[model samples]
Target: MPSFVSRIVPVYLRIARANRPFISTEGARRHIRERTLRPQPYGPPRRLRADVAVTVDHDRGWPIYTLTPRTGQPHGNVVYAHGGGWVNEIQPQHWALAAEIAVRAGTTVTVPIYPLIPFGSADVVIPAFADLVLANRIQYGEVCLAGDSAGGQIALSTAVVLRDEHQVTLPRTILISPALDLSLSNPEIPVVLPTDPWLGHDGGLVLGEHWRGPLPISDPRVSPLFAEMANLGPLTLFCGTRDILWPDARLLVDKARGAGVEVDFHEATDLVHVYPLTPTSEGRAAQAEMIAQLKTALETVRR
Candidate 1:
């Protein structure tokens, strides 16, 4: 059960129709059109926390942001990918979380503002991300990949690509409400979507078409949910029962466990999608757990 603070989110989203862009084909098209016509600024927030230092660089044209704690040397590396259905820019909330991870966990957090759909898709971004993760690993000795929604899909796919192509696997991965299958073909989704305040299959399919590019909807490149899960490192996954993507998370947990992957799964009985990223009390608790997980994982890397 969700607390009053967290449970109120659904009411707000439902009243505001925040799911409009993700629930209808026309709504998605109009939203994307408006964004293309009038682009919003992307990257680190203008007024970032003073305790963290930010450096920006480019990797094959993708903007990579490295955030370090101003206090002292960081312990490990975290590459955070922000989710936007593959077209949305990084949100202020993402920057806040990255900074928190950098400071509280005492690790360098790298946020890659990968190209959106119609500009670049999984094919170009995943390999590039693998290279970035590799670069960070060489410098820091270990790297953790993390993301939410489409970004979570990319982060997981990058790990898979690293394993298949480079014969290397990341040490850890954190996926928050990951959009597992772009195909949106899960029969379970229809049942869950009705109660989901902020997502719909029709709009998701449209965004999926743009995000998959040259690959099929089920391709592992764009949808890692279909990929093999063997030989990967431990995973920290969070999901809520109210989201359409919740069903896929359950399937992933089963597949990953079957493949002998170590999974630390967190499920919210009444919360909505990405509830961990919100400003509610449950979100703060989830963030604290994330920091703890990063600290424990990074401490091992240091040793």
Candidate 2:
């Protein structure tokens, strides 16, 4: 039987969904404008206080936000990628989370603004991220790559590419509600559709189409579930049972395990995708748990 909070969670999600458009429209538009009109040389500083810097990637410029610890030399660095279905979101919300992990794990965090789709290709963006990792490897040592949603896909793909193509070694990776399968035909979609407040099948399809362009939907780079994970680094994946991507997350875990890779998989009961970004108490708790898990993973990497 479902708990009382479980029952109420869906109801609250529905109410939130009804109001999301009005609540998010202005902020979304503002973000779009800032992402578009901001000069390439100058990256916008987030409201949060962190060491902000910009690095040039080929012809394009990328922002790197570094959050350092108060005590102790950094254990390792985390390269955090922000999620927006490959197009719509930015790195503002990630700053707080990055700081939390940095302090808890005694590490520094470097968050790069990877080029979103339609504007850049995964081939381009992934290599740029790899370059960032390679550039900082000496200062940061072994790095843990982390991201949510589409950003998660990028993180994992970049790790795989680095290991396989560039012979680079990443310590580990953390994925939150990762969209590993771009096919979007997973069996869990319908099961969680009624309760997911932020994303829908139609929305995913539209976004997928926008990002894929001329490529086939099954391209392994776009969908890491189909990619080779044989020698990838240890991975930690967090997904809610009520999320549409839960099935894909599970499948990815199974594949990683079968390939003899270490994986830490956490499935939160009765929660939705991107739950950490929600403003509810559940969201806060989820974000806290995520930070804890990331801290633990970083500690493991350091040891």
Candidate 3:
């Protein structure tokens, strides 16, 4: 049986769907304009445990946040990209997760604040972020690429660009509830749409168009679901059956495996989108597993 929290997810998802218009382009534009005048959304940053030091810097003019634990001996590095459906900016929850990963993994984490849609598009953002990750690779040797939702798309796209265009190879890539196919036209999507109350197919499709800029929706940089999967890296993905993106996640996994790429996928039955970020038992467990995977990946890089 699903947990009690799991049972009520659809109710909240429905409520969120009803309130979705508030996050549309018009809404997001207004929110972005007024966001500066308003107080910080994540509240004042509290102190992080484990003596981890957090600093903000810039890479090629983009904001880059660096988290390093006091150990001063990181096993490996992780380059993280945050997800907000290609339009929404990073939230307080994302900051909290960065801190947690820094403390637990005791590794250096570099989070590049890539531009959101309306402000920038895949053509502009992907290369800039690929530069940041490439810098990490040069400085830290092999590094892991990680992200959630749209961030997941960016992370995977960056790796692809590095591999194909720059002849760079990543050790691994991890995606959580990634919007692999921005078109959201998968036949299975409509079958699962009613169950996904948090994400509207119509709104997401619009945002995807805005992100695509002059490129076609099927461009590998915009929709990695269509990208060549071989030689990318070992892939790890997490998604819930309740998420509208679930079908695409499964599709990508199947395609990657068929191409002879090693993939570790965890699909939680009936769970909502980005369950690992939630405050539920399953979410916490998933997070723990991710951390463990990070440690193992980093350790392998050392050997």
Give the alpha carbon lDDT tens digit for every residue of 1-303 in model 3.
Answer: 557887776687676554263335565445445543552332216655547787787646767888888865776788888887776677766767777777687678887777666677999998887878778777876788889988999989888898899988777788889989888889998787777667767667777887888989999899999999989888889999888899999999999999888899999998888878776788778888888788788878888
The candidate 1 region of ten consecutive residues with least summed lDDT is 34-43
Q: Model 2, 73-144: lDDT tens per residue?
A: 777678888887776546556666766677766677887766664576675777778878877787777777
Q: Is candidate 2 or candidate 3 better by TM-score?
A: 3
Distance from true location, Cα of 167 in model 3, Å:
1.9
Q: Tell me the whole-model lDDT of each prediction, alpha carbons only.
A: 0.89, 0.70, 0.79
Worst 10 residues of 3 by lDDT: 35-44
Better of 1 and 2 by lDDT: 1
Segments in model 1 whose C-alpha atoms lie over 4 Å from true places: none
Mark the regions of model 3 whose C-alpha exceeds 4 Å error after superposition: 16-44, 47-50
CA lDDT, candidate 1, residue 282: 90
The lDDT-based order of candidates, best leading, equals 1, 3, 2
Worst 10 residues of 2 by lDDT: 18-27
Candidate 1 local lDDT, residue 197: 94
The true-versus-predicted C-alpha distance at residue 110 of model 2, in Å, is 0.9
